[model samples]
Target: MKKKKAALLIALVMSTCTAIAQQKTPKAVMDQFMDKRFGMFIHFGPVTQRGTEIGWSRNDQVAQADYDSLYHEFNPRLFNADVWVKTAKDAGMKYLVITAKHHDGFCLWPTAYSDYNVANSPFKRDIVGELAEACKKQDVTFCIYFTVLDWHDPDYPIHNPHDTTQSKGLGGNMTAFKTRMKNELREVITKYKPFMLWFDGYWEKPWTTADGKEIYQFIKSVDANVIVNNRLGKVNDKLDGDAVGDFLTPEQTIGKLNMNEPWESCITICNQWAWKPNDPMKSLKQCLQTLVTSASGNGNLLFNVGPAMDGHIEGRQVKRLQEMGAWLKLYGESIYGTQGGPYVPNETYGATRKGNKVYLHIFQRKDGTLSIPALANVKITKAYFMNGGAVIIKTDKDNYKIELPATLPDENCSVIVLELNKDAVNIPVIPVKA
Candidate 1:
């Protein structure tokens, strides 16, 4: 009788633990976001007309007066949200994020809170609303990129000596600026219902961590499911370990291998965020390599594209996107929804895993054979090229040697899928020499 009672107690505890483990927690929203490993970032505004980068150009390249007046002539007659969304869809991107408002203090959407919006510009069209509707129509998730540093808002408190006249007429109260920002965010959330809000320019004065937390909480109060980026109230743009934002936003650069928290690398397709006339763009190989590297690091990639002044995506950019889509079509299994490897990614290659399968991404196809050291504990039941065809893998003690065909499966990167005996993987983290 005593033995039977003990057995019953153990079963009850095991069942309870399993139920608790399966319960949805507060981190579910972030987990869902990490699952979407790739997204598109559209950077478009009046600044594209001058063929200069947005926001920063007001300080160096173009006079604030000319930069601000570009809106007067801003008319993107060729603006087509459907085509833009289609291009994103073709690129196998799960979401589309556009600059609803940039640092130049220009609002692409008609916001009742400010007159410095599309309502007063020559465009006179709701860019945000159109893109939101298009994303919904095409079944792509929609997000908004909003900047806290507004150069035109009356409530904004920041003042640069170079643009004293442009900064004039605005109330210089920090309290008023924060309130206006919150109110504008409320309007955006209620109107667009964005899946995420990618806030930028919070490193400026008057933007505090407390302020970032407040806005983040306010956003959750409006919609608990929405994700926020760490740029909100980032202290000097450094990563805040305890920030209220959902994920860390490392801009313009990728990081070393890290899966501690969900993070994203937001980089441009070309040199500039906004379209520059005849700008040298990244090659198809470079773009694919970026995606693989990001995935290997267990992070998402927000690839940026700057539309022309006429609001049309460049043919060259579109072609590269299409090519990337073709590559993803063949080997997306190794990317989307997969977690970073048990092994830390190195320069030559990286790894991703899903269930009992481990994918080795070979970036450098210099030799016809690839050798991965010190994976003795991992038992590979079968190995094959992700795209197609056979792969010969030999395991000797802790070493894994994969012999590849002379002709590579993909030109940019190749993926080798290995079926493991166990559902979970255990890889030793090799410290970087540098």
Candidate 2:
């Protein structure tokens, strides 16, 4: 009886330790990921040939038979991994996430478990492998985007975005599906050595909390250092909690000022996630502000760009990214390695800080002046424009005003540096009028 009790205690202790291990990521790894602040999200596949959205277009916009067979002619002869990685690097991106497998169940790399992979396609080259090598050569971190829901696989329960006749989580071999998923993920982790796994398509009823926990633990067992996003379980559009992953991923929008947790916003450069001819792209001003706002809110930005069928990024999009790189070259000090504000961000301006210096990012001004709530305990010792000019500062009892020049240095976002008397990070988050 005593032996049985001792065994039960040992089992409980081991289970508790495992749970704790799976829940937390290494601080060093988390810090490194957050410090990057910017990355490239590549959403490319056979769907690029049809000029439709990847995965979701199957059985909706395009016939399932036709969409599934597009891989036969998926020959991206111009797809150069070097060019892709270089494009990201030139755009001041520190990392890259390519879609290894989307909801269509099409795999970019040759996987033993799936016949619907790059090996069978006319291109016949390992897209993920090449990208991984290219990222390494360019000194950029390589990551993978794997979706949890496979619409193409017989084992996976969900299918047909437009088909209401068939219900999810019915008539599918979930056990076999999970085994295949584990096998493919194991291959991805051991072979590619990705720094992170960006998961999606987990909100469907087919995937559950238990499944998410299992997959999360499985990935950690393979590589404890690799980071996972919040989509490993059921999460709302805002990416609020109750999930098993390393960080929060707020898709297509900037996350709120959240200094307590790590988050990254995935937004597209264009309207579409996959390439389309003559697609409208965001202007340089819009792009720069998106990045700046993300940084000002204490979050990272994973800006997406979809390569065309010919495996080249759109020239116009590339030019816009280059413009952003030029701006970052001048004012990157305000964004990189800095934590979000002593003062909470508002419509007119936002703030970021590192050490004793506070960077005030003025997105707009009224009558050549920007006003924000006054800091309670910190004193501004010196103030200057990040570009190359002096700034006039006037402080009242409740608020402070920064008088701007007639012609701002940067039309996209003008940055002002404020040297504080104490460590800016030590100051509590101060709310300002919107």
Candidate 3:
């Protein structure tokens, strides 16, 4: 009897621990994350001085020696964390993710683990710390972008652009390198308390599946509520990973419609990840359409903006973000706290849903008429434009024909609200016809 009791107690304790671990990312936390459909991704580092790509340009476009030494002369006198956070707020971004450490092994903070950080540079201010504080003041969630591979670290196996002779397969102590990475990660978590950690550079050969799992578990151990992306392990072309993480990340493209798991699309406002002079910027129409499609596909959009060397986002980029904010102001209810719709996104239109209402976002139309496949069990009781205009909807056995007005409220994307008798989300997802 005593032995049975002891075994039972041990089993109960183990079960309790498992439950605790599962509850780390509570439903409320995930709901909040999903609700924040839009965020800002800033890729700012010493590479901004050269107006080239952040990490990839180390040896290809610019000489490795010149690229690495740029930090020594780095001094962004105009950098104001408050201004940066405010810019994001004005652009209707609910969260912010900044590069704490890029693949080039340059640290944005005064990390005790490495001397290759902002502290050693001419600008000694803690960029990460200041941004965290600024995010708090602005009521925005602060997140960190950290790379798994480091070119400058002696312990890491790979030294590609920096040393041409030394390949990734070269001899190095991965154990020591992992230990240093853990220490730096712990420091960043403790000091900044970021809500999310956007990891990159996991595609490198040196980083393995075991490493991804360990790092993910370690991060959870530090802060159970923190969110991590799928890039922690080996991922496919779509950026879907096999290891553990809170969400999937589709870089440079919008993710496909997937209600089974959480995802976020990371795309840049300009052509390059880092700031470049005379870079062509995306128009307001393109920006809003991207946001609409991502949300309609049941995903978030992490739009990126590379700040200039002078510590200011290019004037045109800022203006484009302001335009996005303006559009959100008028029709935010169609986006915020809403789920992707029964109508799948297509070239012409997409949809989002909240409770009994489905928002149809029409990007293009032919002769002011749009056709959408009808939901099997759902009935549209009333239909109207989001901005105070009546819309005519004719429902057939197969589809619904919406007659749009001659003049749209917004040319980029016009939202139409459909009041359903039942909850819109319960309806089966239907595809749009060509």
**Which residue runs of candidate 3 sit more than 4 Å off their true CA positions?**
1-24, 161-168, 236-241, 432-434
- Runs of candidate 1 exceeding 4 Å displacement: 1-25, 161-171, 236-242, 425-434
Candidate 3, position 208, lDDT: 88
lDDT of 3 by residue, 220-327 (tens): 888888888888777633433355577888888998887878889999999999899999889898999999999999999999999999899888999999999999
Question: TM-scores of all models?
Answer: 0.89, 0.96, 0.94
Question: Lowest summed-lDDT stretch of 10 residues in model 1?
Answer: 17-26
Q: Roughly what TM-score does model 1 have, to 2 decimal places?
A: 0.89
How would you encode candidate 2's per-residue C-alpha lDDT over 80-190 as one tens digit per residue?
999999888888999999999999999999999999999999999999999999999999999999989999999987778677766733788888999999999999999
lDDT score at residue 135, model 1, on the 0-100 scale: 97
lDDT of 3 at 302: 97
Worst 10 residues of 3 by lDDT: 235-244
Please tell me which model should have the higher lDDT, number 2 or number 3: 2
